[model samples]
Target: MNLAVIPARGGSKRIPGKNIREFAGKPLIAYSIEVAMRSGLFEKVIVSTDSQNIADVALQYGADVPFIRPVELADDYTGTRPVTNHAIEYCRQHFFEPQLCCCIYATAPFLQVDSLLEGYQELHRQQDKAFAFSVTSYAFPIQRSLRKINNGVEPVFPDNIAKRSQDLEETYHDAGQFYWGRSNDYLSSKKIFSDHSIPVVLPRHLVQDIDTEEDWLRAELMYQAYMRDHN
Candidate 1:
């Protein structure tokens, strides 16, 4: 079976009720659930959350809340791996052994069905690879990044300051949308950012991280613009 585990803890400090907050007309998590269902890729789409409210919202949107995440895995410091591993183990105990598992983020409002499909397909094709996840190219070359020091700014890489942007290697970052992994890879707690994984690149316009109020506003604007262009 293929399983989708969406880890949405209730304690969002940066933005209260962030996982369930409204975004572009529905709860933030609804987007992730809807897209996963629409993709028709999973035998089960489950939301592993500590909030009863979150569980209700997830079930309302057609995702199963078979179990509430444990307190230890629901804290701010808990990483995605352990939460996912726990979910996988739970499924195993219940006789729903997932062959492939995908960890879809609740805040990923920009996630698309095609991107998820691509990651799924890529992971299946690369047997040697342990995982596949979404990524997007950095808007600007990171080699020329700056940092504030006292009253002045300084180049992070002084040696790359003189080099043209075109001469620098292009870089990509985790889109924080979804991750596809073999059940064994996840159960083993393998790292996602290693050479063992593949990346499903997404367009920069279709990616945004919503961590703060400003980020939320920017994401809304971006989502509006994307919808207009796509529709």
Candidate 2:
């Protein structure tokens, strides 16, 4: 069995009610729900949320809200690990334990059904590995990243400043869109990235971590571009 869990809490300090907020016509959570449902990959698609509104919306979009997330796990300090684990364990106790579990964000509007299916395909191709995730090449080298200081800002990795970007080894960052892992690894390891993990590189233009208003705008633009080209 395969299960996709979307953890959405009611509280949102960064952007209030972010989970249920409208994005490109539908609620933000709708995107992940829609993609997961349409992917035809998962045996079960569930949303673990603390908000009744979110649960209703998720169900309307064809996701199962089996149970409301605990208030303790719905707080701002609650990391994704616990929420994901809780959902996985919940399903394990009720239904058959899933072979693979996907953790998708409620607010990730850029997560397309095609890319999600591609991720599942990659995961199947490398089933020997513990996990697989969607990622994108870093826009800038981490070595060239900056840090704030009392006097002035300084390079985080000063040694790489002299080297050309092309010469530097490429490094990838989690696109924050989604993660797919074996159920046992997810429950036992407590970490998403595993020794047997592989990164599925997505185009930079298609990747956006929407944390703020600016990020939301940029994602909308990029998604529009994607539609124009693909359609």
Worst 10 residues of 2 by lDDT: 189-198
C-alpha-based local distance difference test score of model 2: 0.85
At residue 162, candidate 2 shows an lDDT of 76
User: Top lDDT: which candidate number?
Assistant: 1
Instruction: Estimate, for each residue in 1-231, the C-alpha lDDT of model 1 and write its tens digit.
Output: 799999999999999999999998999999999999999999889899999999999999999999989888888799999999898989888858899999999999999999999999998789899999999999999999999999999999999988999999999999999999999999885789999899999999989999999999999999988899989
TM-scores, each model vs. reference: 0.98, 0.92
For model 2, residues 1-231, the per-residue Cα lDDT tens digits are 899999998888777888888877778898888888888988899899999988999899999999999888988798987898899999999987898899998878888787777777887888677777888998787778889999899888888877888888888888888888888888776455756777877888878887888978888788878888988
The lDDT of each candidate is: 0.94, 0.85
